[model samples]
Target: MKHLTYFIIFFSSINLFGQVNYSGFIDKYPIELSADINTSGNSYGVYVYTAYDDPIVLEGNLQKGKLIFFEKNSKGNKSASMTFEKFNLDSESIEGIWKDLKNGKELKITLSKKNEIGDGIIQKTSIGDRYFRIVADDQNVSEIKIFQKKTDKLIQKLKVDCQFRGVHCISTGDYNFDGITDFSIFESSYAGPNTSSLYFLYNPKTKKYFESGFSGTSLEFDAKRKRIIETNQCCAGSSVTTAEYKVIKNKMILEKERCFKWSEKKQELIERKVSECR
Candidate 1:
């Protein structure tokens, strides 16, 4: 278990693992999990992937993983265990349909039932902005599937147009500062009509596709000189409105419409209004 993938999202208050940064783009991968009580069954419940063409759409059961205890050893002829799951995407892809965990210090029982993989950085964005994602609904609800963590076969599959099986995906950062990376979106419809939106669509320099604002749940961008950052969340609240739209030289400048701010550097949960346009 060298660390790769395990995403289980249950934020009743969140605190079993660590790291939870959700604003625009968020990619934190030290994906890890380990367990061993070998007897022979050769324990296994894994998720380690890196065959990227599309499939990276994980966000349910916070992505699913379950590695309970294993028993049958000492000669009982069954306790030979092996449960080492991993998923880490170079820090973080899926553009077709799109959709979106881990633990233990160590408990090795290596028996060649080997498992461990790689990949990283799937978040960091800018430019017209919009990228936030999460997904879940099955995989035993936590058997493990954190976006390409070894193919149960599901890439960008969030039907109902992301109405929320639990936590759907799309949120990474670069904010038009131009380093390249922006696919912002964070939606949670809670079953009723919770509501969420934010999709700027990739535009890595004339790369194409663009659309911003409406009920854009969360968005942020930076494309070298081009810039955009956004946050608009309303699950079913009242007439909540905080505006800011920037595109300048190309059109879309509201400069600042609604009013609200608490960006002590950008630690905002709500209340937003920062605009610019050309």
Candidate 2:
């Protein structure tokens, strides 16, 4: 019925244990599924309808090019089963049959490997002059392609190591405060608000983006002030660090830093250390 252009990945033990994310439709209804099969053919993951966002437990096995799996309800009762007659996790797309174990009705199942980060959503900006694309593979790897919009010519392609797939997995900005916009890909995240990204700064001379070794924890860019700020928390949020940097020739130079310790008595952050570049 309702076609959804975006979907969220439900992280569980399956995702943590390295499952491949997939997106497609089951009888014209958008669905997202994450699954992986072990060497012994044991399959596991979660399936969800984009409209409802309810996760159904999935478990089954792969046998002789056929993947047979069942969806279990919240009550642990088997609701339906699916058989991918020519199951190949590496295939671009898959077609199969879904059987309702209770009602004996059938529905056509079609699925394709999904990219957690890119979905052709960011194509109308200044860079839209080029057809930009980000494709993620089964190995948590992504390839970025920039093509000439008018001639459909490919400009550049880069390999990147990344994880997850969704809106939060990609971002664009001018990290170096340059007039041209740059982009970044999410790498990983730690506890609290601490996270990291791989930045690709725009290069005017080369007409391409180059991966800058610039990295920090929870980075924030201040275009007006021309400064980069990094916020980090540790020790169960009892300690905090804030570092300020200035972009010098595309490299971040540390300018000043301050450390704070959580005060248990006053229930506030107490400044512990302050330093500046010598």
Candidate 3:
């Protein structure tokens, strides 16, 4: 009857329904976390966690995915069930629509190929839907996608350069001092010395999305009409970072903050939040 978050630890354990056995025991017994997992193949895996505290560890070949969990007694009786849908996809995919569903969350994930983790954008839409995006490796990349809902099809896809590998977990709701909700992404390719590359792009003006900053991965924020602030490498050992945006006059400022302690309050997230950030 207690609430304790459990991280996912994958071992060569027994495979129940096919997929990697990313399961572990939480401090509390009978704790289950609900997650939605997707991959390059149609066949995906859903990890039913017994806890919701700590971290969700994913090793080896990983893909864009989430987790859902449930609990039952020794008599095969069901208790509570929850789903943690965290991935970066087009705004019109099923995962996008589900993000707008009831009890949705505002979380981000790092997309990866094997061991290389790519950054993604995740924001709270006006109508509760999640606005997630990810830039390609370079300019040849096309179309930045936003997930309108978890189960709905991709609704909005903006064609943009692939130069930046960010946009994974950001908000398009005017985080900067710009008037419109411009798309912001962070690309961190520099990992050599004490410096990192960071860049911010805005589209308030016609055919002008080039912002000023270094190029590297970052936690982005959109304040609708303020400034564009990018936080590179939110913290050490931080799985995902949330970017905070605000608008003052004509400046955009971004910040990285921990998630709100809204255990059950978040369940009441209204659809108005993600109404028109497409």
Candidate 4:
């Protein structure tokens, strides 16, 4: 598919996740915050200053009545931090301290609630042996939660690097052929049945899910053969490509590929070429 990339839309004001929207000042710099506090006391959100063009991702936890958030840069590194001594959702305004990790600079933060959306619950479904619920607005998925199927115990939570627009589909398979099921989310759609997804594989050693950087177009897992099939079609279905991959050390190793071109004479697709990947 098209190169995997995050599509960030600019908005002067955001109602992200339809959960918590705030307008605030960070030491005289105007800022807007859109966030959600999950039931497990974990928080994930984004904030942007009026003078900036991009938003900074914030991830943290609420513990002992304090909200501690770390500002994540584009590379997913914590560059700064914010700790609110007293944060109450019902409160109109709250205060906090912002600290830059690199320069050791500190600033006062004060935010006033601008709006509140009802409990953010975009979709809930179960796959394999886990229950998942996505917390997001109609535009984006901010957090994904995994719960034990039998006990309903929250096992893991993650923030994905993709957007959810319309119908969101989650797929699962034995990607590594390790018995445990791995899952993925549709990332985006492209021309003529071309799409990409973000894969999260189950790690039995850590008992957690890890995001896999596997890239392919419309990947389909063949559990019986333990292979991954990537299908791509373009040019009004006239050009097509299919690739087969084998999992080697938890990585996809391409083995075979085939190309097809539509033939007007035969009124069907004809095999154009075939090759093997080394």
For TM-score, the strongest prediction is 2
Reference-based lDDT, residue 70, model 4: 95
Whichever of 3 and 4 has more lDDT, that candidate is 4
Task: Report the C-alpha lDDT of model 2 over 1-278, residue by residue, as the tens digit.
Answer: 21112121222322322356678899999876766566677776566565644445578888798888898766889989988999877787899988999999999999987655353212212254554445655435467666664454668887887764432344688899987789887787677667788898988899899999899987889999999999877766667778899999999999988777767776666777544111
Candidates arranged by TM-score, highest first: 2, 4, 3, 1
lDDT of each: 0.31, 0.70, 0.32, 0.69
Worst 10 residues of 4 by lDDT: 1-10
How many pairs in model 2 have backbone atoms within 3 A of each other, for residues 3 or more apart or on separate chains, i.e. clashes? 2
lDDT of candidate 4 over 1-278, digit per residue (tens): 22112122222222222256677899999876766665577776666665542345678877667988898676788899988988787788999999999899999999998654332232222455555555555566767777654454678888875565321345566778788888887676677567788888888889899988789988888889989999877677677778899998889899988777766777677776544111
Residue 209's lDDT in candidate 4: 90
TM-score of each: 0.25, 0.55, 0.27, 0.53
Order the candidate numbers by lDDT, best to worst: 2, 4, 3, 1
User: At residue 143, what lDDT does model 2 achieve?
Assistant: 70
Candidate 2 minimal-lDDT segment of 10 residues: 1-10
Candidate 4's TM-score reads 0.53
